[model samples]
Target: MADDSNTEYLLDASLSDADAMAYVPDPVEVPYPDLEYVSTPETADTYDKYFYFHREDVSFEEALADIRDCDSLARGLNSGMGYQDVYSPYGGLAGAAGGVIGNAIAAAIFGSAEKRRIRRVNLRRCMNFKGYERYGLEKDLWQRFNFEEGFSGEAEHIRQGAIIQQAKVASGPKPATEELGR
Candidate 1:
């Protein structure tokens, strides 16, 4: 129905470490825990649902380019850019191994066409594929290529944990926002 293979948004530091820093917002005064620090491969899987469908016609390099765009969008969001601001071609990097090596590993993971077909169907029902476009993809590649979706339910569970922790931080305690003299 749609390509899902082009879904995952992996982060690679192409920008000099300095430039990458610019994509992060300044620390908030309230001393909140860093969401970025808590981001694990599992958390990424929450968004990884986008790649559930894939197209075989598209080359591996093209697929990786698509994923890179997804990564860029993710960074922009983390930097405080609105969803509309980050909207454009190629949101972040794609492919396995951070988009540097492209999809060799992914193909290996999807060895059989039958397995891929099953994965795609499961992915659509389980993950939040809507975010994938901002991450890149009109439709997931797995649909086109019949590739199996790679994301696991574990990602959603872990994200829920992080959300709970963030909520606790927000509601637990506070320091005065105003300067001492003011």
Candidate 2:
């Protein structure tokens, strides 16, 4: 029902790397064992629901712009329960009650957790289409950079921004750590 295209968000002025860094929070690391990474070609697996977009050729600023574009696309797809044209055939008080009931039904069917999950899916799909890989992370590490679309608080938005800004900059595997038995 939506355009669902990559060319939706246009960038006029390019941002410098230093400018992009301002949006990211402090660094975070997800050590091995607890940190399992996967790339979702279809969609994320149940436990590996968290993800960020990465591409080899893009600059950090370009990646940031793409992230914002995908976020916008995701938001457009999940703009929440607004079945505005749902008017009842009945008149007066009965019609008002029926409208309320209809709206509630729509919310139940399309709002909440499922919508948020779809938002994430749509975001990943967008990034995938734009030649980016979807790198999945375990929840704790994912939380450092992402927020559920429908449930984002101020902190979550900041975290989302953090990931958007950091995705390309932190693009590859972390450096090796000393083995436990070593």
Candidate 3:
């Protein structure tokens, strides 16, 4: 049989192997994988900071699937398990009042700041569970090539997907530090 010992490890990668799969080579002082090492120049004078994940052996398809699954899980958890049956309340005079109530209720349930925060936390947990480690970057730099949650509209979706796809083999997300100007 073909040697799948390594491939099997990838399918159910455990946190125990995290250190063995370092994304960044240790300054070339020691032997390392032939993975590409990326160094980005400063674009903006300042940046809002956030963390992203990196695993040396992950394929683009795996990363994209993991991100999508996490996004769905986070949103579903934040929105709750209620079956919100929408009945049009704009039918008559009394219905107008019901419409207003429906709007208020919807607003209260969806897209609140708290809900967004909870979603982010859940996303982080799910990604971590998949053996991804967090690395920090300036917000401006990250948005250039990542799939962030809470972004809407078709154009934005296409742009994000394209950039991420283009960088399918992108590796080595360095932590934002004092020198990087985060």
Candidate 4:
């Protein structure tokens, strides 16, 4: 009989392992936004001023999602379920990781949802503006509706729906022979 260990070794060598393993020499650093790192009163005031002045360019839904992301990170950091890297010079690697995850989550929501849900939420919020209900004009809707809840839930729903739709399409029937001109 053939040696079992030798046969196993041969099988392992023949099988392609590219998909099962990766040899990343260095871990890529994740880019994260940190509002706490905004040093000085001037920097803080700048964001606030921008928020007030550029309300037209920015939507309430986007702001709400950002807030939720930050809030989630803060909660995670405070809960102590995170770890800190030994080589972090700033002693804030844990918070940085949290921020990275939060930002990634926020970005993923927008990308996966096709931005449909966020647009819808913003539109709904704009339509519900009571202050300018009489005029029916397009204006800064945030002045009337406070997006405390953010559009995170709606965005998530849209993302999930898109994923399901994508899967359904992928698993759908093959094109007709006539349609394929086969």
Model 1 error, position 150 (Å): 20
Misplaced by over 4 Å in model 2 are 1-44, 76-80, 84-92, 95-99, 105-110, 151-160, 165-170, 174-182
lDDT (10s digit) by residue, model 3, range 1-182: 12222111121223233332222222222212222224355522322234456656776656656665675577534444233444664666666667667766765666454555666678678877887665555554454444333323223333233223322422334324432211
Which candidate has the highest TM-score of all?
2
Stretches of candidate 4 exceeding 4 Å from the true structure? 1-91, 110-114, 121-182
Please, what are the lDDT tens digits per residue for candidate 2 over residues 29-135? 32112234443444334433655555666755566667767766776355467666556677788888788888878777667676787777787778777777654
**CA RMSD for every model?**
22.8, 11.2, 12.5, 24.2
Our model 4 lands, by Cα RMSD against the true structure, at 24.2
Q: Please report the TM-score between candidate 1 and the true structure.
A: 0.19
Model 1: per-residue Cα lDDT over 1-182, one tens digit each? 12122222211324454343223222232233322223345534544332322332443333333433432233211211112222325546432224433334444444333343444333333222322212222123212211122223222222222222222232333322211110
Better of 1 and 2 by lDDT: 2
- Which ten contiguous residues of candidate 2 have the minimum total lDDT? 1-10
- Predicted structure with the largest lDDT when compared to the true one: 2
lDDT of each: 0.29, 0.52, 0.45, 0.27
- The residue-level lDDT of candidate 4 at 17 comes to 40
